[model samples]
Target: MAIKEGLRPGGRSARVQDAIHSAVRALLQEQERSTVTVPQIAARAGVTPSTIYRRWGDLAALLADVALARMRPDSEPAETGSLRSDIRAWAEQYLDEMSSEPGRNMMRDVQASATPGYCVAIIGAQLQTILDRHPHEAAPSVDRLINLVVAPVVFRILFSAAALEVDELHRLIDIALRLD
Candidate 1:
C-alpha cells in the first residue's frame, strides 16, 4: 500500500519514499526537530527540496509522515479474549511509542501543526476496531474509552517532564476499564 496519500504507487516511488523516511529519521536522531529543514532532509535523502515540498507540502507535514510511519503498529493488536488485556496491550504499545525521543518530537510537530487531532483519531479508530471484536459488557463508546485511555497518557506526557512508568500506565488502563 502507498505510505501516504498522493504518492505514485510503484517501484521507484516506493524507493524514494523509503529513502526520504530513512533520511528524516536519521536527521531526527542527530538534530533537534526545529533545526531540521527541508533542504537538509532533501540533501540527505538525495532528492531535491522541491521533491520534498511537492510530496509533503511542508516540513511539519514531512515530520508527521515520518513520525506516523515509525509509530504505526507492525500488526493488529492481538486479541487476548478480554477487553482489559486488549486495552492494556494497546495502551502499553501507545505509551512505548510516545516515550521515545523521535516519537515525542513527532508529537510536538503534529501538535504544533494544523492537524493536532490526527493521532487521536487514528488511535481511536484502532481502539474501536478492537472493541468491535469483543463486545464490552457496558458497551462504552469509543470516545469515552479514548478519553479514558488516551487523554491521561497524552496529558501527562505533554504536560509533565517525567517519563510514564509501566506501573502508571497499567494503573491508567485499570482506571479506564474500571468505569466499564
Candidate 2:
C-alpha cells in the first residue's frame, strides 16, 4: 500500500515491480547480502536480467524499495496515554521486528548496498512517517522517555557485542519511564 502522499505505479509496471521485490526478499532469506546478484534475482523472479535493470536501474534500488515496503506496514506507533507505556510498546515493536530473521537480512543488505544513500532516503522516509504519526510531546520527561525507547536500543544494536534480552529491554523501558 502507498503512503498518504507517495506515488504508486500501475499496470504492468506494478506487476513487474511486485515480482522483482518478492524475488529479492526471497533471495535475502536464502542467501547472505554479499552473495545476491541481479542475475540471481532475475532467476528467482522468473524474469530476465534486462527487465530488472530496466525497471530499477540497479539491484540496490530494487532492494531498498523492497525493504521500504516491508518496513512500512508496521510503522504505526503505540498510543497509550503514559509516555512510558507508549514508548515501550513502540520501541519493543521496532526491536522485535529488527531482531527477526527477515529484518536482520534486510539490514545486512542495506548496510552492504553500494548506493546506500538511496536506501537511507527510503528508510528515513519511513522513520519520519512514524515520527509524524506519534507527534512528539512537549514535556522534557516525555522526550527522555521517547529517547529511551529509541536511542539506547539503537545504540545497542549498533555497538554492543551481546544479544539483547527482552527483559533487559523491558528494564530499559522501565528506567526510561522512571517506573520503580
Q: Worst ten-residue run, lDDT, model 1?
A: 1-10
lDDT of 2 by residue, 2-51 (tens): 11234456766677777888888787778887789999989887899988
Off by over 4 Å in 2: 1-8, 31-34, 114-148, 165-180
Model 1 residue 41 lDDT score: 90
lDDT score of residue 46 within candidate 1: 98
Give the distance in Å from residue 128's predicted Cα in candidate 2 to where it truly belongs. Answer: 8.1
- The candidate scoring highest on TM-score is 1
lDDT of 1 by residue, 42-135 (tens): 9999999988888788887788777777656677887888787888888888887786765677677677656656677788778887788786
Q: List the residue pairs that clash in candidate 2.
A: none
Error of 1 at 120 (Å): 2.4
In candidate 1 the C-alpha lDDT for residue 52 amounts to 84
Question: After TM-score superposition, what is the CA distance of residue 22 in candidate 2 from its true location, in Å?
Answer: 0.9
- Hey, what RMSD does candidate 1 come out at? 3.1
